[model samples]
Target: MNALETNGLSKEYTGNWGKRTKVSALNGLTIQVEHGQIYGFLGPNGAGKSTTIKLLLGLIAPTAGTGSLFGISIHDKRARERVGFLPEDPSFCAYLRADEFLDLCGKVLHMDREQRKKRIAETLQMVGLPDKATTRISQFSRGMLQRIGLAQALMNKPDLVVLDEPLNGLDPYGRKELKALLQVQKSQGKTVFFSSHILSDVQEMCDQVGILNRGQLVECGKLKEMLPVRNVRLKVSTMDMDTVNRLEPLVASMTREHHHWIIQLEGASRTDEVCAILRGHAQQSIEITRTTETLEEFFFRRIEENNLERGITRPEPIMAMAEA
Candidate 1:
């Protein structure tokens, strides 16, 4: 059975001023996360990413639809008892130590004294915060705090782990270590559901991904299935403005730096024709460079395509896993 499943889930909030604004934080969102899979949920601001997480966690009542964890209704306390969550911005009792905070979370999960102790120790070690267990929450660095947040989430060793921007405020090293921990968790047969705004992290960590925009999930599936076809980059050592102008419109875009021109083609479809065109007017020798599309390229391409389809403009593309 899937670890987490949602069918037409949605949430709407009512304002304090009695203004009738029906903001659908989640609009008929439907998704399913399988066991041991790291499902990456991608979206722009106000795209209902957190709302879905909150609904699945039973932190708030869903305005519409239903979801389940481990075949149990999300509204059931037993279902929540089997899952763990870490918010993007985690805050605990500032005066309490890391160990104490984790203890509190363990108690909330109804763990016995002996069970909580062993689980807390293991989780702290798993997240690389074992040595700093006694350190107060206020004294921890941003990276340290993030790690503790993860540790607390794993205190009960729940079957489904949902992390909202798990790498938020983490340093380069911390991010690496946390990613390694996530892999270990998956290897142990646990499901990981994480949302991120960094495409690279999602690409590297998630087995499957879903892209959301304007409260709608536009794409979903394995990364390999969604990867675009090969594309080539051309570097021509030419100073003639006429040759550059001639090749610019034939391809996607071109950049000129000093006497060298960098030309980018969308795919391998007509690259041979482009090279032949460049060769006809080359004032100097040119070099050909080839590279496949990375996860970021795939993400940007999807976002651009969605914008064109809906005729709605968006600002610069949001970076995955990087946004708070």
Candidate 2:
């Protein structure tokens, strides 16, 4: 069974007044996350990413459709016990000590006193807060607070970890540690699903990804298939000007620096044709490399195309499409 599944999941908020009265935050969203895979959820601002997380965690009821965790309904209490969540901005009791807050969280998860003790120590060490065991949360720095929040989320040893903007407050070293921790989680056969604005980090770790635009999923697929090698760069040294002229029409761009010549071909197919022309050339050496589209490039391109299709010149407020 899939670790997480959603079918036509939609949410439309209804309120008393203002443009926020009736807002369609999400629409007909369907997705499945498998076990032991790191799934990255990406989207532009106001793209229904927050609303989807709220639905999956049962923080709010969906206007239509359903979701399940490990084959159990999202509304079921048991299903939530198997999942851990870290919100974009989490705040806890400032008066409580680091261990105290985690102990309370573990209690809420129904962990025994002895279990909470051992787990709290382990989680504290895991998040690099072991030295602050007795320190009050009010004394922690922004990054330190983030670490504590992460510690609480993991106290239960959950099967699936869901995070919203997890990389927001972390420094470079903190981000690196967090990524390593996520990799460790995957090694232990745990599923991790997180939403982030950091595309490079997403590209480095995610096995699969789903991108939302204007309340709908515009793209969803494995990373390999989404960003395939598209262009080829051929570098050759000691090429004659006559050969350069013969190669001009077949390449996208060609330039020379000292004795080194660089040429860009549209695709791999064109490389073969170019190679045929220089088959017997007495060149020093030839090197060819393929380049793939970056996640940032693919993201903006998809969002731009999707926006154009929906007649959105720019990002509009939630009220732009609200109904009351």
lDDT of 1 by residue, 1-324 (tens): 899999988888776586877776787888888888999999887778888888898888998899999999999988977677999788879999988998899888889999988988999998887798899999998888888889888887878899999988888888888789889889999999989987888888999898887777888888777776576788888646776677767788888778777888887777878877777875466677666678787777887798799897876545843674
CA lDDT, candidate 1, residue 245: 70
Per-model lDDT: 0.84, 0.89
* Candidate 2 Cα outliers beyond 4 Å, as residue runs: 17-20, 234-263, 268-288, 315-324
Colliding pairs, model 2: none
**What are the TM-scores, per candidate, against the unseen true structure?**
0.78, 0.83
**TM-score of candidate 1 relative to the true fold:** 0.78
lDDT of 1 at 17: 85
Q: Extract clashing residue pairs from model 1.
A: 196-321, 197-319, 197-320, 197-321, 198-320, 198-321
Candidate 2 residue lDDT tens string, 116-222: 99999999988877899999999998999889988988998989999988888899988988999899999999999999999999999999999999789999978
**lDDT of model 1 at position 188:** 94
